[model samples]
Target: MGSGVGMGMGWMWLFWVLLILGVVLLAVVAVRAFGGGVTRSDRGDGRMSQERSRARQVLDERYARGEITTEEYRERLSALGEDR
Candidate 1:
């Protein structure tokens, strides 16, 4: 009878732990679904900035390597709307 009681207590403890974990998981999902827990940089604006920076870096590399003429580089840079 003592062993049975111990087993029941152990199962109850496991159930409580699992219930808490499940509740935490649900809260995380709800926050993400509602866009409540994310910052601005985690959205599309940061991605756009990254892409523009990458493009400018590649353009600078190509210009340094003499793969493009100064005139062509200026034209492309202007097209990318980046300042000199």
Candidate 2:
């Protein structure tokens, strides 16, 4: 019983470490996935408009997937100047 309790404590510490590591990994991935501080100059194209185009494409895909409503898609597309 005594040794089992000690093993449980060891597992508790392991859980804490894993939780912290998971959070750090998620933060990094989220930043990169959202294109944190990414600029068009970073792309060889020298034009930032391509970034907007990609974002618009993603929005359209989401709209087609029914993840966003028609009104919401229109609003966002208008904001991105992709609308008539």
Candidate 3:
């Protein structure tokens, strides 16, 4: 009968350990969700910006050379959001 006391104590310890582990896991998840541990290197070095600028430049050059219709240039530029 006395052995049951140790069983409850062991369960209590296990519950506390699990609670602590859960808290730590939630904190890690929150940090990752908020981009706390990520860095500029993970984003590929302004790659999107470079691509957009290059596309805009090409559009401008093509428009200058009258190679593409104004409507086509405007539509593509707007799609890329590089018309600004």
Candidate 4:
């Protein structure tokens, strides 16, 4: 009887652990599905646009300083798709 009770308790513990893990996994999926995480770029705050402008300014400054050749500048600007 003692051994049986101990075995039942062990299984109960395992069941609870698995249930908790499943709940946690479900919560994580729900959060991701609801877009509750930060994105790599564009946080919907206009900050991404500001960062792009800053990058362009830096690129222009580099070109003005003769740090980068015109070809390289044009190539980089085209890569940035700002040429259009």
Candidate 5:
């Protein structure tokens, strides 16, 4: 009787584990179906935008510090297409 109860409980645990896994799998599929994930191209565009902003910030800082002359700053900004 004791051995039978243990075997039954083991199967019960397995059933619960599989149920949980199925729920998780379903959620993942739903999210993908709903377009809730970022695509590679989207990520690349965001990264490029960030890099451009960082470069602009560095240029601004250098100009403020007199590390670059106004003419040089304007030239660099134009080269970066960031003239403003």
Candidate 6:
């Protein structure tokens, strides 16, 4: 009787642990679904700024490497709508 009682209590503890884990998992899913799961790249202007900064860096590197002439560099920068 004592052994059987201990076994039952062990299973009961396992059941409660599993139940709590399942609830937490459900809450995370719900939050991601209904809490506006917007990522960094989806923030519009911020992402555009990051892209423009990257473009400017690449352009500067190319110019530094003498891959393009000053005229071409100025044209590309103007096309990108950036003065500097």
- Give TM per candidate: 0.47, 0.44, 0.46, 0.46, 0.48, 0.46
How do the residues 1-84 of candidate 6 rate in per-residue lDDT, one tens digit apiece?
455656677579889999999999999999989998867766877877788889999999999999999999999999889977
The predictions' CA RMSDs to the true structure, in order, are: 6.8, 14.8, 6.8, 7.6, 6.2, 7.5
Please count the clashing residue pairs in each candidate, in the order shown.
0, 0, 0, 0, 0, 0
lDDT of each: 0.87, 0.85, 0.84, 0.85, 0.88, 0.88
Alpha-carbon deviation at 56 in model 1, angstroms: 0.3
Instruction: Report the Cα lDDT for candidate 5.
Output: 0.88
Candidate 6 wrongly placed segments (more than 4 Å): 1-45
Q: What TM-score would candidate 1 get against the native?
A: 0.47
Candidate 4 local lDDT, 1-84, one digit each (tens): 455656667578889999999999999988988976667565677787787888889999999999999999999888777994
Q: 5, model 6: CA deviation in Å? A: 61
- Tens digits of per-residue lDDT, candidate 1, 1-84, equal 455656667579889999999999999999898966777656766897788889999999999999999999999999888968
Model 2 reaches what TM-score against the true structure? 0.44
Candidate 1 yields a Cα-based lDDT of 0.87
- Runs of candidate 5 with Cα error greater than 4 angstroms are 1-45
Residue-wise C-alpha lDDT for candidate 3, range 9-73, written one tens digit per residue: 75798899999999999999998888777666347787867877898899899999999998999
Q: By lDDT, who's the top model here? A: 6
Better of 1 and 2 by lDDT: 1
The lDDT of model 4 is: 0.85
Candidate 2 clashing pairs?
Answer: none
